[model samples]
Target chain A: MTNPTAAMLVIGDEILSGRTRDANMHHLAGELTKQGVDLKEVRVVSDEADAIVAAVKALSDAYDHVFTSGGIGPTHDDITADCIARAFGVGIDVRDDARALLERHYESTGLELNPARLRMARIPDGARLIDNPVSTAPGFTLGNVHVMAGVPLVFQAMVASVVPTLTGGAPLLSQTLRVNRGEGDIAAVLSQLAADFADLSIGCYPFQVNGAFGANVVVRGTDGGRIDAAVTRLAGELGL
Target chain B: MTNPTAAMLVIGDEILSGRTRDANMHHLAGELTKQGVDLKEVRVVSDEADAIVAAVKALSDAYDHVFTSGGIGPTHDDITADCIARAFGVGIDVRDDARALLERHYESTGLELNPARLRMARIPDGARLIDNPVSTAPGFTLGNVHVMAGVPLVFQAMVASVVPTLTGGAPLLSQTLRVNRGEGDIAAVLSQLAADFADLSIGCYPFQVNGAFGANVVVRGTDGGRIDAAVTRLAGELGL
Candidate 1:
């Protein structure tokens, strides 16, 4: 049986403005794929409460898991925690557990946990904190919606901490074969072969080689033997 | 005056699965930014029709313009055109204008425009074609939704054709100062300065430098004078 699917909601105005090139989507995609949890969708929204609430509710219902990144920072724009709380129809406040974590960090760092900073401690009720080794601000998992940080280092660390604890399906396996041919040149034959291998997903990624275009044929599947066989057949047919 | 805000809807399963790293979002963001339009959100949904319809409707109503990439292809999975039509409560069929373009291309290339290929010609009623110079398949603009090809080359060409036709506002001006400072060391000052520049957006992008984290600070604003002032103040504050 195929593993359960997941989605990602990247919330930030900075991302859309091209002020921030997102690293969270790429990280989550690679991580989820490794865990056999197929990332089925990804949405990047602004810091608006309505947008965040709408996307969170919609995606959480569609996929088995929904991991959100950004807008959970200490700044005034950080409204993801509150928006998520509302989406889940739950009340949120500064939790003792989260506040303690922030308090300890500020004490050690000798930095005051100001009102803006304290905003990070307001997690939705019933949500469990995901450990953040990079920073004291804790990420929380509310049902299937995993709320995380926007900063790449902190987000990656939090993801690493949370992913290991969840149940994973069969790991996804992939192999890439570089074909010094264009997609149009190999489409017909490759399409037929792709149809034959029903279980495996074959994707042709085109890249420029010299002045011409070439394709890197990638075969992905849970079954190692099937993937190997498909690669072999592909290489043989392409005369590589 | 600010250019109206826009959002991108990337309709593809390939992106979510990490089979394809999305080029559309980057391309659209840069293009819109240059045209003085602020891209506010981006959503990457699967090929599922329902998901596509929901995303299209929601995004169209929210933004001044909605740009959709992917799903307009000559394959079974290419369902973007139909979905957009459905979302608009419109009917989709093979339009004469689209068929003419495809017919011309087929005649020139001496390739049969098969039924599968003709699927590319099917477009929503009352839609204007967004020409594809690189490929024969034409994208179309209906209402506020500009449905474009998923292929990067085709998508870029379509965007080039569409951007010049749209009205725009004041373009965002930005300047970057590459620094060899760690974010942690500069956090307090940077945070304070960022708070001061309400109209300007300051983003700290960290990179690994000699096994240490170093960041390049970027300041963005619609007013060139404000951006320069912010940068000057930031430099003075950071003692750079």
Candidate 2:
């Protein structure tokens, strides 16, 4: 069976403004790769409600699962929850379970459960909460879309909580050989090898390191044996 | 007048596979911000021809300009040039000017200009070359899409060559106030300030520093005076 496909939507004005370099996309990509889910596409959009709603609708329809990060805090700009609610055409308000969780967490710290903080407890209709072990403010899974925080640590914690619930295919296996030659010098043989191993994917990533040009030829496939055999042949051909 | 809107398409399996963290997007975002180009959206797709072509067409049609990075090298996997041609329904081949530049660069280094290396010389029909000062392989501009190298240095160089030729609006100005309090504590006043400065975009980015939660409230607009006024008002209300 084909691996389940996934897409990521990153929403933040900080990322779009170049004020923050996004770390969540890279983290999610790696985690999904390990889970045997193919991350086919990733889109970064501003924190505007229209943009978020449009992206959420598109990604939800196109992929088996959609993971979103950012715009889920207790600030004026944190409108992701509302946009998501609108996208699904669902009624949203501060749910009791979520509010109780937040209330309990803040009570221990002697902080008031004010209206602004209560904004985090807003959940779309019929959605289940995704646990946040780092902080009591929980992320939620609405349909196939899993919405999480913009903060890297909290995002990772939520991912850990959500990953175990999803079904996954066989882990993708990869082997790499660093060839001490430019990609041009290695392209012909690499092409032939790729043609020979039709089921495997051969990717050549060239780099200029310490003024020396070379490439890392990576072979990836679900079948470990096939990937190993292909990598061996590739290494022998390149004389690496 | 509205600022020229742009979208970026980053193509590479390395990025999607979590083998590489993308640097070009952040660099381009900052440069475009300084040049007053509104970067509205960014998409990262794997190194597949169909994916690249579809994204290229979509972004190019939607935005004033489209900037693409990666998949332009001389490897078997480098299919960006051919994909761009297909996306625009134009023919592609090794142009004489691009080939001449490559030939001269290789000659100086005593490297043979093989077929694999010559792949870099391929340019789409009716395209103008974007200069690559760091590397001799030229990036090309076809229609509103500017294709650049994946390597950060070369990509930055190409951007420098292209940005000066494009028409830029007034540079976007931003002023920020750091409030040493939780977003919940600051949200009410922040919302009021945002409403007062409806023409300017106001964003609050929450952060945790030294175990204390706070936020950076930023006001951005083309009108420097308006942005400054909004920031001043925000700071006064926040008592910062």
Candidate 3:
């Protein structure tokens, strides 16, 4: 069976403005790869409601799973939940279950459950809460769309809670052969190898380190034996 | 006048597979912001032809300018130039100008201008070449789409060469105030302040340092005086 495909939507003005270098997308991509999910596309948009709504709807409809990060906080600009609810055509409110979770967390920490903080409890209808072990505010899963916080720590924790529930396919296997030659020098052999092993994905990444040019040829596939055999043939062709 | 909007399409498989973190997006974002161009959206798609073509078409239609990085290399997977041509329904081939530039650079460097390396000279019809000081391979500008290299040094050089040719708007001005309190604690006052400065964009970003929570309130506008006045009022309200 083909691996489940996923898309990530990162919502934030900071990222779009170049004020923040997005760490969540890289983190999520690595994590999803390890879980046998193919992360096909990623989008980073400003914290605009229309943009968020459009991106959420498009990704949700196209991919098996859509994960979003950021804009789920307690400020006026934190409008991700509302936009998501609108995208799914569902009503949203401060649900009792979510409020209870926040209430308990704040009470234990001696913090007030103020209106702004309570806003985090306003989840879309028919959504399951994803636990936030680092902070009290919980993320939610709504119809294959997993909404998570922007903070790296909280986002990582939420991913931990969410990944186990997902049905993953066979993990992608890869092997790399480093050829200390320019990609142009090795292109013909690699191209023929790629055509031979049509099932595997062959990619050549060029690099220049300390004024030395080289290429790392990576072969990826789900089947370990196929990838191993392809790598062997690639190594032989390169005479490495 | 409203600032001209721009979108970035990053094409690569290493980024999607989490083998490499993208540096071009952040670099381009900062440069575009400095040029008074509003970077509205960014999408990272794999090095597949269909994916690149789809992203290029979408971004080109939505924004005033679209910048693409990656896949313009000398390997089989380097299909960005062809995809760009397909996206615009234009004919593409190894242009004389680009080929001449590569030939000169290769001759000077004592390197072979082999078939694979020559593939980098392929460019769409009716496109202007963007100079690459770091490498001989030239990027091209077709319509509003500026396609550049994925390597940071070459990408930066290409951006420097291309940005000056485009018209710019008033530079975006911003002021930030750090309030050493939770975002919820300052939400009401900030919300009112944001309403008062409707001409400016006020965003509150929450942070936690040494177990103490605080928020950074940033006010951005094209007008320096308005941004300054808004920051003064915000400082007064926060008693800072």
Candidate 4:
């Protein structure tokens, strides 16, 4: 069977404008890897309704699971929930469960909940809510796409709430060997070694140390035995 | 004047596997912002030739500049150069200038340059090489797209070499204020304030502190006066 595939869509102008260096993608990638879900793709787009709808439809169709962060706020640009609803061809209305959650949250704070805040209570039909203990506004899973808040903290909290319920495959196995040599020095042997181990992925990440070149060879695979074999072969090829 | 839009295409499987959290996006975003270039989008695709080609064409047409990271290595999966050439409907050949650079780099290191290592010397017709002082494999700019290596250090070096050549608008100005209050508490007023300020973008980012909810409000714009005014009004509304 093919590995379970997932994609992340970071929808926010804050991220795109360089105002926010996104933590959502890194956090989601790590969490998904631990759960054995293969994160195949990630796209960070501005909070445009058309762009969000198009990306949502395309990614939802391509992957088994799609996680979207950002644009789910009370602000005008927070159109992710509505755009996602439109993508699914479903009607969006303020749901009782969502309103109840928002109401309880506001009741405790002694702040009168305005209609704008109630916008967070809007839910697409046939969607299940993901609890957010950190904030009142809940994230929801509609069809294959999971829509969460733009804020990293809120997004992470919602992800933690949702991840436990997912059925996962075998955990991804990986090994890394740091090499002091430049990538060019190890290019030939590394290519041949990579070709020999077709099942494992060999990635060469170069770094600079004191204005000199260095690289790290990372070998990853679902099977531990295959990953180990690849790493061993790579090390031998490097004459380590 | 319209904001100078830019997009980034990150080509790698290591990122998807969660082994590497990309540092280049944040770096580039911050750099572009200072240069008055708006980084509008970012897409991370695997080292698939077709995917790279398609993304290059799509993003290049849509934005003023397309910055790509990764898949510029000498390994088999490093198909970005060829894919980019194909995307632009051009032919790639080993150029004397690139070959000279590679030859010099190899001679300085006293390493025997194999045929596979020389693959880095291949350049597409009509492309300009972007300097990579850290590594011999130089990135290049073809049309509006700038293709660089995945390695953070080398990628940064290439970006430094190329960014100053591009035309940009006014630098985006931003002011951030942190409030030890939940986003939900200030969601309504923030939304209204955002509507009132047509020029400034008000972004609400929530944070978690010792299991308590808090948020940071960031106001961004090209006009420093407008950003300051929005921030002042927001702070007053929040009673901070």
Expressed as tens digits, the lDDT of each residue in A109-156 for candidate 2 is 778888889999999998999998766888999999999998898899
Q: State each model's CA lDDT, in order.
A: 0.82, 0.90, 0.90, 0.85
Candidate 1 residue spans exceeding 4 A from truth: A106-116, A175-219, A226-240, B89-119, B174-240
Judging by lDDT against the true structure, name the best candidate: 3
Residue-wise C-alpha lDDT for candidate 2, range B1-240, written one tens digit per residue: 889999999998888878789999898888888998988999999888889999999999999999999989887889999999999999999999999999999999888899999999999999999999887899999999999999898899999998777788877778878888888888888788889888888888887787788788888889988888888777787777
User: What would the per-residue lDDT of candidate 3 be over residues B31-62, giving only the tens digit for each residue?
Assistant: 88889899999999988888899999999999
What DockQ, on C-alphas, does every prediction get? 0.35, 0.80, 0.80, 0.60
Candidate 3 chain B least-lDDT 10 residues: B163-172
Please state the CAPRI-style docking class of candidate 2. medium
Clashing pairs in 2: none
State TM-scores per candidate.
0.82, 0.98, 0.98, 0.94
Looking at model 3 chain A, report the run of 10 residues with the lowest lDDT sum. Answer: A205-214
Kindly report which residue pairs in candidate 1 clash with one another.
Answer: none
Q: How big is the positional error of residue A155 in model 2, measured in Å on the Cα after superposition?
A: 0.8
* Model 4 interface DockQ: 0.60
Q: Please give, for residues A1-240, the per-residue lDDT of candidate 1 as tens digits.
A: 878888899986667876657877877888888888888778888767888899999899988999998777665456789999999999999999999998998899776777766778899999999999876789999999899988788899988987777677898889999988655566666678779998887766555545465767778889999999999998899888
Residue runs of model 4 more than 4 Å from their true location after superposition: A109-111
* C-alpha positional error of residue B11 in candidate 3 after TM-score superposition, expressed in Å: 0.5
Q: Model 1 has how many clashing residue pairs?
A: 0
Greater lDDT among 3 and 4 belongs to: 3
